[model samples]
Target: MSTDSPTDGAGAAASVQRLFRNTVVAVSGALSRRDGRVSLSVSGLAYFLLYLAGLRHLGFGPSGYEVSVVSNPLVRAFRQVGPFQWEPIALVVVGPVELLVAPLNMLLGAVLAALVGLNLAVSIVAWRGPSACRLGPGAGAMSGLPGLLSGFACCGPTILLVVGIQASAGLLSLFQWLLPLTVVALLGTLLWVGSRVETAQQVA
Candidate 1:
């Protein structure tokens, strides 16, 4: 009574494997597209360079000279936040630039953390459906914009304060909150986009 060919089962398995492979390729290709990759790389590299500069300024690099507390607007803002603990690690005079290593490190860390969140969001969206795979990279990049804006604004306020402009404590607090909000927004955007794409695919 049962006359199903063995090859039928093997063929079905092979077909599924092909589909999975193709989906992976499509998602990776979309993320690695020229524009998307450039945007991500530029942001990542900029953050890394800034972090390196901060390290150098703190006398922890090849061009380092001394350990001194560099007072700046950003440093003041960080002090208000109380998230970073700044301490004098002995002095060995080298230059005359005000460099707040703790705050700079925090800024770089936020960028890296944001980037990781965005990547996860993209991966989720890309794996959801074919349409989502097409939309994931661009949407992920757009979502990351808020984080970048927050990072820039964090430093911007301090710069203005350094220039003798009155920067409000409330404004600095708002920037501090923006980083977490950006991560939440990115996750939401990816979920929403993925749902819409899945729905559209179903309807089609």
Candidate 2:
């Protein structure tokens, strides 16, 4: 048996460096080198985190559910805008435009408006590194945690079953509503899977 040479260790080190460099370049394109990756990765992460955080502003949450059947704010807004007025100006051009969208529009304006507002709010706020860097990233990560668990095999139908049970009761506790919510999550998963399958088939 022969002992390893110093040249062999040097070659190994160089190979690792090259591999790391290539990986960074692939995710981040030309900008992945040095400090650029830090900035881009942080910002992208912030944007995604904020987007999920904004969903909290929706009427539903862990504490209690809003029992009202009224349209969500965004849906109301969309109705006011109408098909003809869907241009860029609708976001902040006029406050009174919301009034028009609320009652007159045929579609779900309030729900649409609320979603847009939530996403925009999250994007703007999360970009500032909101609070200290540590806290901000932590918060963002927590907000996104639900999306990760969604991949569990039982998560989909489990939710649907829970939701059905809650609906049967005619009144639901906070945790009880989770079933229906789970079902909705499952439906979203199915849709995503369907899309992927369709795309794959098309490619084939």
RMSD of each: 11.8, 19.8
lDDT of 2: 0.32
lDDT of 2 by residue, 84-118 (tens): 22212122112222111122221222332232222
lDDT tens readout by residue for model 1, 1-204:
888698999998886665555444433543655444554555546544453343343323244556654456444544433323233223454454434445544564556544543444344334433344554334444533443454454344334544456557686555545645554554444444333232234445
Runs with alpha carbons beyond 4 Å of true place in candidate 2: 30-204
Q: Where in model 1 is the C-alpha error above 4 Å?
A: 1-29, 47-100, 103-108, 111-113, 116-132, 136-165, 196-204
Every model's TM-score: 0.41, 0.21
How much is the lDDT of residue 148 in candidate 1? 44
List per-prediction Cα lDDT, in the order shown.
0.46, 0.32
TM-score (C-alpha, index-matched) for candidate 1: 0.41
